[model samples]
Target: MGQGKTSLVQRLYQRAVARYWARSARSAATARLAVLRQQSQKAQDLRRHLNRVIAVSQSRLALPLIGSNSFPRPHGTDWAWRPELWRQPLDRVGIASVANRESLGAEVTLFHDCAVSEVTLRQIRNTREADLAPFGVSMDVLGFDGSFLSLVVDLPDEAVRGLKRSHVIRLDTIVEQESPLEIFVRLNVKHGPNTEQVVHELPVNQEVNTVEFDLAYTKLNEKRVEKAWVDLIFEGPEMNRVILRDATFSRRPRAEF
Candidate 1:
């Protein structure tokens, strides 16, 4: 009987030990799962923090670069200044008016074929937050049935005098767009009854913004030159908001070879 009792006691001890080990294994697995969850959350949080820091740094860095003009010039510069759009407020700024009659401050006119019924143009004052000049042109295009939308700038009569073939006309502009649209910039010279035009395709990148007109190639009648003008035309510009942040005109004589 004692031997049987000893055998039973040994069996009971083995079962208790097995149960204890299984429980310990389950507890260890639970602990490992909890640690993994905590680690994953921490990693995600760290990524979010890093992204925020990077955004803040980039924005602050761009601040100093605003309103800065740096162009390469091998020849002596004749003129460099911002367009009339930024120098002062328009006589009429906030209201949307007929493109034909929209007086965009001095020396500039906004013109579009979209019937007076379907076009909207507003001159918005650029807040200090934009880090831009004093004003920007805003256009909301809807049902644009027109063949072309353009802003015409009439150059002063003085621009034609003392203007030689060796001089180059350069235009600098800043445009902010909501949708991608092609823009054509043209410089028109009217001497007597003949008008000669030079067209340039504005770059696709928003930051891209200068166009150069070399007068040497044109057969311009300097003596008969009576008028000068610029055209900014937008093609396929439906349902878009285009902001002209700033524009400047400059001329420099080409370096003699």
Candidate 2:
């Protein structure tokens, strides 16, 4: 049968069952034995199917709404974005014992120098009212012996379109760590054969987690800009559980002096 017809039948069946229960509660004695027998038989036949539907419904409905791309952006912002991991569900929900050069989603990748990997990366649904993104990423680090660990997010073509040295790229994120840690944000702009990198120490301990990169400071060749990406470097992240509740990027022109 067609999906629409099947859904209609299910709704009608639910209405009839609801009415039956309401009447049964009022006067069970009024129910004839023949009708009761038929009702029992029908309910027994439908119980397994109904239970399956209920289970699937609960699982899907409990997740945050999908395809939510809206987020706060700065004034005069030409571009704003929340990475794919925070905007949609991944085919693979998580990774255990993540190795070097491993990736969670299409845009995010984990790179480390540890020999024996002891890290896990997972995508989680954000259900709190204060959460701006529909999804988040969680990382658990234990006994890490890596000299460097960072998550890289590749920006789409739109981020590099019409790029110029006059623009100031901004990074805003909400991170919760088990202990004190310093995180740094690096903006990489590939222009021609050379890549320009701008690094800023993310003030994660402050009330607001934000950092900006002024391209004017970097020797970026705007005319030859090809691609851009961001790196989130975690310093001394051993034995820590870090949840990146939200990460967003925005670009705006710097005000003239």
Report the lDDT tens digits of candidate 2 across residue range 187-254: 99999999999999877566358889999888888789999999999999999998998888999998
**How well does candidate 2 score on lDDT at residue 157?**
95
Ten contiguous residues minimizing lDDT sum, candidate 2: 58-67
* Residue 32 C-alpha lDDT in model 1: 76
- Using TM-score as the measure, the top candidate is 2
Candidate 1's clash total is 0
Off by over 4 Å in 1: 1-75, 128-132
TM-score per candidate, in order?
0.66, 0.81
Scored against the true structure, residue 112 in model 1 reaches a CA lDDT of: 70
Which clashing pairs does model 2 show?
none
